[model samples]
Target: MSVRRWWWVAALGLAVTGCRTTGSAARDGQGTPPKQELQFDPVTVTADLELDKLNDEELFAGGTSAFAANDFKQAARYFGRLADFHPDSRHRRAALYNAGLSHQRLKEWEEAEHRFSELADPEKGQGDALDAAFRVAESRYHLERYDEAVKLLGTIAAREDLPVNRRLEAQVQQGVCQLEAGRGEEAEKTLRKSLATYEALADKDEVDDYFPAQAHFFVGEIYRLHYEGVKLDPAKGSDKLAEDLNYKAELLLSAQGHYLRSIRVGNGYWATAAGAQIGALYENLYEHMVNSPAPAELNAEEAQVYRQELRKKIRVLITKSINIYERTLETAERIGSQSAFVDRTRASLEKMKALLLADAEGEPAPDPAAADGEPHS
Candidate 1:
């Protein structure tokens, strides 16, 4: 079944109470979580209204109106007031959630963190409260506080009482945070488990697949980074270089396995991401193999022949990369994918073709092959 992709890409908009609703039960976590992106011009506040003059109802009504209109700026104001001054109001909880969500939409991480923290109270840590915690963790993630995000998301994921989807969201995010924090071993375990759980779900179409796609991609990223880090040096002697090449190939294949799985997950964004990565694997392999220092014992004549022959061999790598890039570009276009990975894929395809052309035209370029390190997103 066709599924929604990212959280922001998830079409489930916030309700008047700021909770997401779905056809499934709330316990499924399908109806839990907030969203992002600003499609409408935000409503700006021209003047500060006296809080005493307007009742809690008025504040909530205005907030809901503004929120529905995607005027998150005003929504934050109204909801923030409803949460702060009218603490006794029944709308207080939703107010806090919406206020944080509004601030989050506006990219006010501190404000969003503050508001969500109020609703994330452990005493009331159920339903909306859990959602609030999730948002707080996301705010931390945006803030690059990966450790804090990981801790909070771990807590959220451990709650067996909440909806599985919400827990899944937390779990997936925790793995991503782990990845960002440079916890490769921990990130791999967390992300692999996330993929397993995602696959075990009975109703896969009912929730966003972004997390699973992320799991696959980040797991691939872990090994891809490893591949990039693993260096080969002919200066270390042919035997040691042979061992290094074998180890590097293992890392490369490991990375490739996960990238292929990411593509198989079939999310357009991640597929392009994986596709770009697959191309990168070959491109980088070319870079690794070609850039190694020539053995010191070689005569100038032998070194020239070595360079020419090695160039001939690694041209296949460039060809493989170009093919992968071309195919990825086709997929990106067909899926209407708009991601940095797609942009990178386009850029890489051009570079690979140019490098190949340079080889054909015998034009001077970087030694052997060039591989630009792919971004982590």
Candidate 2:
């Protein structure tokens, strides 16, 4: 069935089922039973009245059920109806929030953006409004509207009214958007700010340790990407490019450190992700060492020293990659209990080991095929 049609059917079902009303059986009184009456607590009576009068609770419940059923459009409609019918109901704000989520699930980007935008306005809904604004930015980000996402996230990051953790998340997401937009320098700056923010929070013990680990991982990814960019560009071979190469190396090493830190403090999904990133970084570094050009201005002794340093770095990275893969394999085995991913990890580790052995046995040199008469310039 078409998703839209299925959604409508689900909505009709929920609407019918949720509003079914029940009543107590009538009492059969003989002659004068002393006029006994049932009494309800004030709070309970008020709650029941609110439930019956507003119907907001039922609406939200129906929306949640529809969402669980993967009927996102129905969920949106249910929540949207609550927001429309009970504009002043206490649950109006929550209804709007869930409506936005439903739109997100349905991939209705513009509708999600609109719902989030409405909730984000402080004058419109003061309590959870800031959180809604952040979600708005996040929605824009997933839509690949980088510039708009960056602007919205930057505003949220700058707001003193927002919680520190949310500010940090905003900053990290902003950095990610910047990186995606190919503004590496700006991305580096934003990521550094995020890391510093997390570090400060860590020092105070005010932030969850997970936030710091996430910041570290994100910063590491930024650095790793920067390193890969230089490695991929053939034009970056000038003497002036030496600084870029050194910077790349420094960043990769820094990223390796952070990834390792994340692995140490992380578990479950974060641990797996950090381990994979660490292994990938090491693999990339190893590839760079394998492909690096020989120094153009090195004497015999200097050349020997350079080659030795390069080999040492390569060795370290290979060992690191192996260890990361081992950790990933163990984690996957624990989680999935002999899944296909675990088997793939094992196979990859075996291949990496063979490659490491071959690299160790062979002498390092520029590929003969790359020795064509033409210069890179």
The most accurate candidate by TM-score is 1
Q: Give per-residue CA lDDT, model 1, range 153-187, as digits (tens).
A: 88878877766677778888899999899898999
Error of 2 at 217 (Å): 1.7
Q: Kindly list the per-residue Cα lDDT of model 2 for residues 245-309, writing each as its tens digit.
A: 67776877777777766666553555566667767766776887667766666678976787887
RMSD of each: 16.9, 15.6
lDDT scores for all predictions? 0.75, 0.65
Relative to the unseen true structure, what is the C-alpha lDDT of residue 54 in candidate 1, on a scale of 0 to 100?
72
Clashes of each: 0, 0
TM per candidate comes to: 0.75, 0.62
By lDDT, the best candidate is: 1
